[model samples]
Target chain A: MNLWLLAAAVLLVAAFGPALCVAAVAAPERRLIAQNLATVVGALAFLLMAQGYGRSPYRDAALVLAVLGPAGTLVYARFLGVLPSSRTVLYGAAIGVPAVVGPVCAAVGPGREMVKVLVIGALLVAGGTVTSVKGDRHG
Target chain B: MVSTVIVIALVLVGGAATAAVFNRDPTRQALVLSFLGLSLALLFMAVQAPDVALSQLAVGSAVTPLMILLAVRKVKRESTDQDGDESESP
Candidate 1:
């Protein structure tokens, strides 16, 4: 793939994914689904770039986003008291595992293929957000 | 030419779907908007952006519906008025 195209994809995913997710949650109706989907895709694109064509700087950037994105969302939701405190703790535990594992895998795995895993893992985290948020609101 | 036409058609369809959201009730609006996301992902794939397509699928298909359901639940809980009958005309 062309380097610039890869870069553009990464930028779009990173900038728009979380923003849309946050907006969807805040907005009424089914917008949350759109935002969540955008977030997952965006995170996945960044992950691909980080592994396939990105430099160390790109990898590092993805790492920061991976850690902070859900954390920030959880925090915002918590402050809003949308979910219970116990749920936040659970989210923390869920997020913490990959936060440690991704860097470790990147350090030791072949060709630092951790990026691909991390991207998918980030999608999983996004999934958790969906589940937890949905559970709290519904059940 | 065909590709250009397709792209234009996709954009138009996506735009119309989004605009339709405002006219519908919240639940319908949300569902339609999610379809918009699907359409957008397809468009990305059509343009040879598989990575983006995958991401869109992951988030759009999986995460978005749950979130919308949650929001809808919250609204329902807060409203405490189930009947679609309110009598204030302005």
Candidate 2:
């Protein structure tokens, strides 16, 4: 019922979902299991955020980040021929699920805390973008 | 509570940076980056922003490592010559 809780829930989902997708694609023999486990923990945190925040703007923003970030990355990878065209389906799922979740949260209740969460989500996405393209010459 | 979370987030960020610089091997560097992603995810949670953290964990920790590993494998494959015929054929 409370807005903050809904905001938190959205944040958690947006954060963890991509991690799961990544883990699924990662090398099996390497430390993928550990990464998956960690991602699961993060996903649980998002579920909590959804429960607490309910449906709100915060959730909506998270949904955007969740969908866009990975989709964008996948698109770029695809263009470069890193990922096969068939894998785009997974990208769709990654974006679609969160897109649905955001609207559900917003319809239930929109609150101020939602805005704060959205802002933070935006900043994180921006930071992530910078990190991905920036200094790491190793890439 | 927010302040404490922020502090923890900073510490995690620092840890990530430290790990990246200290590790020499590219594979090890990739692993450290995963740790960085995990830590950053916690930092996101600390800030009461779960969505960002989750995404970071996914891409930074999971996807990036996979890509790096793939690249490493490709490099390794290229370096090793499997066919003995190459030396004899010429």
Output the number of the TM-score-best candidate.
Answer: 2
Per-residue C-alpha lDDT of model 1 across residues A1-139, encoded as one tens digit per residue: 4443354344344434343444434443223333333334444444444444434334343343344335434433432345322343235336543654465465547654555565547555655455345353521
Candidate 1 interface RMSD after superposing interface residues: 10.8
Off by over 4 Å in 2: A1-33, A47-139, B44-58, B82-90
Docking class of 2: incorrect
Native A-B contacts reproduced, model 2: 0.03
Chain B of candidate 1 vs. true chain B, TM: 0.66
What 10-residue stretch in candidate 1 chain B is worst by lDDT? B81-90
Tens-digit lDDT track of model 2 for A53-75 = 44333343344344444443333
lDDT of 1: 0.46
True contacts kept of each: 0.00, 0.03
TM-score of every candidate: 0.35, 0.43
Candidate 1, superposed: residue stretches over 4 Å from native: A3-38, A51-54, A83-134, A137-139, B1-90
Relative to the real complex, the DockQ score for model 2 comes to 0.09
